[model samples]
Target chain A: MSTTEPKRRGRRPNGADTKEALLTAAREVFAEQGYDAATVRAIASSAGVDPAMVNHWFGGKEGLFTAAVQIPINPAEIVREVLEGPREQIGERIIRRFVTVWDGVGGGQFAALIRSVAGNEQAVTMLREFVQNVLFNRLVKVLGVDHPEMRVALCGSQLIGLGMARYVVRIDPLASADADAVAATIGPNLQHYLTGDLQLLA
Target chain B: MSTTEPKRRGRRPNGADTKEALLTAAREVFAEQGYDAATVRAIASSAGVDPAMVNHWFGGKEGLFTAAVQIPINPAEIVREVLEGPREQIGERIIRRFVTVWDGVGGGQFAALIRSVAGNEQAVTMLREFVQNVLFNRLVKVLGVDHPEMRVALCGSQLIGLGMARYVVRIDPLASADADAVAATIGPNLQHYLTGDLQLLA
Candidate 1:
């Protein structure tokens, strides 16, 4: 049988639009009902699409979540930017990039994210994925370091703790202080966490 | 002042028992409904006492919360124990104590406490009080070192982060890890955080 080549392969005019619509709906549903509580049918209904479409496009809720929360910054790209120059200075870049994301999304997004994690099981899974895959995994690979997992987890904890105190809990001074000010205060410790001389103590 | 002194001096016979009962009720309510949602009336009702009893006994809700979550271990006692021995070994003792409290409480109490922090405003306030007054305040006083407040806060962040990862999220290895093992892994860093040389980088 003679086969014809596909008409247009690069970009589907409507595909991006549908994906965005579904993602927005999925985020709201997950936020409201949590992971176990939100259903595919509910998400599809909210998106004004057939339930079968979600399965066809996203594979399932897990896939939809991964797609929805994917940060615009590419992990490989971030690793390159962060790891360039002497390893000693990497911590500042890391902190600055993290701060940029927080400022770009604003406090409300972080609050919503924290709420989702507290309220929903799926949200925790998603959070673990975002931290482990999108951020920590790449950083570990780039650092090519020992205790990579613990180091990544430790960095995550430090950053998250700072975020919780500054944004979620709204602790005095930290909450009210300028973003650059905080980055200056906490950045070096984080850098040390990533590539510091821990073996010296050992 | 003289007239009031007599009233204060002539205490009720069962005052201690009643106060204990109220505290028990307050803990249950605070654990279940968190601080803000757990009304004084409800706690009193649970305790089978009038709402006025809470006022008569603990001053108000905030005071009641202080009593509810108070740990028996004194920070002064802890600092004394640490400082009594070699400064280098203080880290191990500190880590041991932390593990003891976390294990003693069982995961459920901590889960309830964390859930309360997530769900209730009053719980957050009460938690802040407990962290600030009973925990951090004591640590700061006993450490008797420079930047005591910041040091204490940072130490708290590490401990709380460890708890969140271990108990709430149940991160493996660490979650099921033996108490002593965990103490060894995290203790030295925490020790450095508490009393090590942390002069600002040039």
Candidate 2:
């Protein structure tokens, strides 16, 4: 039993070591190259792990990205899922998913993430690139919208603001409000940003 | 002249002493009673200074609140000014003023404020109350909106998100974009929150 316990502990640490190594390497690569440009093979090579280990540990590049970035949700997966639905309802879907996922984690992690981003320059850069390019930008391109840069910024602002108000600041009504209600309240504005006519600011 | 230096130094320290005392007391008082309820007399009394010192040192209750909160601009003054304009243009006015005041102070202060809010529970509560009650909630009431709570939250989210994107994270295009352009791009959305029909979340 003692011998088997040692082996069991040894195997888990070995697995954990690989995952740690991958996360370390992935943060550097993703911040430097962004989500679309950074690849599984490159990250694995950087971590000195087998290419398959990316899948084994993080399920894929998206999961790895989520872990490395320290954001609890799989933003890539959420984006893909959010886009799969009717374009008109995308705003509601994003808000609902956001509230559900963050609330699921007890919402404190959102504040922690904000603290990390506020204090760390690297985290800020990674999140900035992720919010602008990896997430909202991708959504903008898929929609084939004009002024993609502005749209992404607008969307980023509202979404991040909603998270701050509800989770971090715990603003009443909005803070205590349910996900469906939040979606209904803020969804239309988000939809307007996504699909409505916006005057070009530049 | 050399002997007179003692008197000059004595007078400046006396002035600074009053200012310092007021600020210390104001922080505690404002945090405790909020903007409207916390009177200049109370803060001055708490600091062991005369009520006139509130205006003489910091301009008035509004200015004292500004200094006490550590926010660079007078939110009360800004609110008063923004409301003086046509209601339809209020959103644009707000974006323009927000960008101008923060930008005037070089915008870095916004990040500093965020860092403070994220790390300190007291700062979080103060800001939450300020944004919801002192700022947006007042606006909702002026407009006589149906769902005042939701409107305030929606507006709070977008405005804070805009600040985070433009000033803190420094997200592209949005970050570098000119204020007029930003106002035009984002104003309509703000107007909707201020005056538009929003489906209630509760």
Candidate 3:
């Protein structure tokens, strides 16, 4: 638009277009097939681009999924980091990681995410997938916990609740609390949800 | 104005108008003054009605607040019931109560509340007041819990999260689980937040 502006750099103009096409294709494929069955190759093919573009643009399925949903964090990285820690401390790690990521970008990202989830069925589906298929799925598989489904659901509830409290509703002293404080208060309960007993739950 | 309709019942003529006026006035007063400081008399006066109309229509202050916010449950009765229970079992009572109220109305009300909360700042403020000033405020006052504010917030987070999972997202088997199962599963965690040692929360 600006005639005096320098020419667009190497492959830069169409790159965004390609990425957008892939994002659109990814949404359609993922919506139809969900996280487990929706393959990167299918998404690429649907986008009319080479399969390698999936890796080149998004680094993998999880990244592409995160991009498609506009989630602020990468599921692959978060899951990997969450699992890398000791079993007993997993909850604290989760709370810490959550606070750090959301706080790093400021709170607007999570508020936006919640608003989207509240308003959009597709967003709700994406969130459930991110929780069940992406994040907790790996954790429960590694832990070999009883009532794995319940564990995942419980974990999702607490973490999402934590996000709502801190970012969306801005409740304090929880909202103003530092990461360690949040972990200390909420982590043990999260740990219980993750690996605790359930005789009564029956 | 249907001629076929029965004579609209006794005092039915402007009763609906009075209730609507009270609701509108309650919203403005609660919005400006919050749950604790707001008065039923002020709300009734703002609606240009007798002070007794507040009690006649909405039961009391909590009823008026819930009505103004279009919340499905009565916070006064809930707070009363939650407080009437033994201290140790308060958490189970909470989970059970929450599930029953939402389930009784079907899941639509909680989902609608979340949607409203997500979309409206005034809704957010009202919810915060409902949590801090109405529900947890009394519980904390009675139980004398440490870090009362944090406990209130943590409770808010988990309960709201549970509502989202069970009703909005329908993340089973927690979503499909009966009230007893949910109470058994999530109750202790709530108890911990309610009256457990919060030493590390500092």
Residue clash pairs of candidate 2? none
What is candidate 2's CAPRI-style docking category based on DockQ? Answer: medium
The candidates' DockQ values read 0.25, 0.57, 0.51
Report the CAPRI category for model 3: medium
Q: Interface root mean square deviation of every model, in Å?
A: 3.5, 1.2, 1.3
Predictions in order: chain A TM-score: 0.80, 0.68, 0.68
Tens digit per residue, CA lDDT, model 3, A1-202: 7767565575577878889999888767765554555788899999998888788888888778778765556877887888885889898899899998889768766776676667566678878888888888888988899889889999999998899889888889999999999998899999999988964543
How far residue B57's Cα lies from its native spot in candidate 1, in Å, is 5.2
Residue-wise C-alpha lDDT for candidate 1, range B155-185, written one tens digit per residue: 6656666666666555544556666766666
Best by lDDT: 3
Interface RMSD of 2: 1.2
* DockQ leader: 2
Please give, for residues B75-172, the per-residue lDDT of candidate 2 as tens digits.
67877888996889999999988888878767766776676677666678768878887887777777787878877877888888999999878887
Off by over 4 Å in 2: A1-71, B1-71
Higher-lDDT candidate of 1 and 3: 3
lDDT of 1 by residue, A1-202 (tens): 5386565554366666667778889877865654556788999899987787677779998788666655444677778888887788687777677667776766645555665566456667777667766787788776787777666665766666666665565554445556565556566667766777543223
The per-model lDDT (C-alpha) reads 0.67, 0.79, 0.81
Q: How many residue pairs clash in each candidate?
A: 2, 0, 0
